[model samples]
Target: MSVLPRTPPRVARRGRAVPVGGVLLFAVGGTAATIAVVWWVAAHTGSAWSPGGDLAVYRDAAQAVRAGGSPYQVDRDGYGFVYPPFAALVLTPLAVVGPLAGYAIWTVLSTLAVPAVVWLLVDHLTPAGDHRRPTLLAVGTLAALPLSPIAGTLLLGNVNIVLLALVLVDLLRVRGPQQGILLGVAAGIKLTPLVFVVHLLLTGRIRAGVTALASFVGTVGVGALVLPADSVTFWAGVLDSSRTRPPGEEAYGGSIRGAVLHLLPEAAHGVWLPVSVLAAAAGLAVAVWASRRHEELTAILACAVTGLLVSPVTWYAHWVWSVPVLALLVARTWRRPAHRRWPAGLLWLVFALPLPWWVGYVLGWAPLTEPAWMMPVDLLYTVTAVALLVLAAVWLRRTAPAARGCPR
Candidate 1:
């Protein structure tokens, strides 16, 4: 140490070490670029863009709440506002801001929060000495960002990102009473996330499942107690609308069911419901089997993604939620030293290719196209969805047993 501090052995390297500053620059630069692009698209498109219809709906609901009207009571031309009143109450502050400002704030928060939540989940899953792996996981997550439907979701002002973060956070915790409470809260915010209760049951976490159900029921009870007559009216209206809403109006891109129907005009749209049910059942069975044999969070997430895909009403923007699962799969697959690089390469391709298709749709290229051009895009969509599903299945098969034995 007296002789020039002995040239700290760790600093003596044969190759150039990665500069932390450079890494930070890259991350910040990339995020900035992405934000700029989305902002430009949102600003220039203005009211011409229809992809963010959900955002419009949310904004409208917020306005209604601020106007001393029940969001549920306000008839939104057939797409009745069905979200819990608490959601509108929470969004009241955002409503005070104009739509553009509110959307911008929401987009930034969602984009930033999602990755951070994923990192936390990964950290929880990894072993003590494996802390370094979470950074790799985060990088893979970033790489998959382009594929995230979050762009569409953000543009549309969907609350799914927050719902997704809550679900993922709940899943990462060891199955317990508190986990149930988290699950309940997420489900109460958005009912679809309630599917995780079934997942817990399938995974043999009966106590957790019961707890989640109880929490949901408790929340509902509280809502009923506070809102009373309004709660009943909301439930009735939602049920009526959900049962009777016309097709095409509700179907958005990104759902496997919707995508398949959009791709196959010859097929009856009603077929989608049955097909979706079958797909969901099959996916659930597979997920349960995987969980029983391997217990990997990625596998469970893949199942959840599959369920969303098979659901009849899922929109393209909701697909952003799958990006984290896809990223985790890529990271795990890449970790296998002997594995060929093709899988990773293919993953990148799948992640990047569909984005242009979405852009094309937004630009009205697909709708304006002749049958020939439209057919190809539809075919491509079907192929990509199938490919992603197959890849998820393969990953689940590979990671299940290892995850089962993993000390969480």
Candidate 2:
């Protein structure tokens, strides 16, 4: 018999095998480009930034925990390790490996989140035999790699990706007694995801919501056992929101509060609080409306944006929720008519381009020189967040009558 070349093997995803050799190459190339871009930022950012500062903070916290000390005690006011005590307990292994090894592991895990998120989106939104799924997942992964939020999260060693993944999985796939476990654990690591607990309750997912609450308590109990002092300090509000880094023009701190601070003035800063509250309430109401109509992705994303807007601080990395937001918009509108699809394209450019960070970088240009309106451009992501809330409300209102044959 004539010798024959073996066929390339396929990888299994949600029980379906996909021929994804091209995607692997694209992922590798995209990662190399992302690394090069980070080096460029390191060489150019001057004293304005400390590359890997967040990672350093994490390592320091881990070291403190490893030494049988409190991570809270090591805070020196600048760029502190601001996560919950349970996070420090979970990160203890990073101390054992040391900084360099820990950083490498972190990078691999963070990069892997892009594809993992894409896979989850694909598996949930598209049918198993959909011919376009592999391509869409690969393309989405590459497109997400360089979003200001995603790239910044990688640079900062933030837990946003893990939280995003946890939230996505819990809502999209998990449907049993274990459904809420991931979201609860995520909220334990960082409290922002508590908004999802609200999301679950209003959407009639009472069991999952209660289970998630229990899981959160479980994490806190574990933290108390492992690092009682740190847990006590954190629960007592040792890390106040006011002590966080300034929502200034130098970085992509694009919260609704940050926007109000920049656009108005110091005297107007207090307005952001009530503004955040109103925005969050409106966003949550829209989320409830979407969930009632079986618009699962819309409900989750509405809550995501609400959390970001209502947060005390929303750095560029916090916009990591954009990945799934984009994935959802594209999935819903990619093959529709131009009028229906154009919004997806516009939103893609909003994230895919470096516009928000460019707004930050350009402020340093002497010619620009503190023009009154210059700083608000840094609020691109923030503006998009607000726009999403409005869009969800309006769209849901218009579609309510037809969705599930339910009356508006």
lDDT of each: 0.61, 0.74
Top TM-score prediction, candidate number: 2
Expressed as tens digits, the lDDT of each residue in 1-408 for candidate 1 is 010012234554543555546554555565566666677667655343343456667777778777767677554445546677656665678778887777778777766655665565556545443424434444644674576356656556677777777777777754546777777877776677777888888778888888889988877776677566656776666544243233444333445655656656567466766777776777777667666665456446656766576655565456655566555555455445655646666655654555675566557564443333434443454455556557667755665355334522
lDDT of 1 at 408: 25
**Model 1 Cα displacement at 364 (Å)?**
9.9
Candidate 2, pairs of clashing residues: none
TM-scores for the candidates: 0.78, 0.84
**Model 2, span 1-408: residue lDDT tens:** 001111223423345555667767776677667666654554465432334567777888999988887787665335566778899988888888867677668877877887899888877666555655667776888888867678877776677888899888888889889989999999998888999998998888899999999999999999988888778788888436754563353233577777776667664557978998898889999889887877777788899999988887787678888888887777656557768788877887877555344436634553333334334444887889989889878877775333462211
- Off by more than 4 A, model 2: 1-19, 32-50, 75-77, 246-252, 338-340, 353-378, 400-408
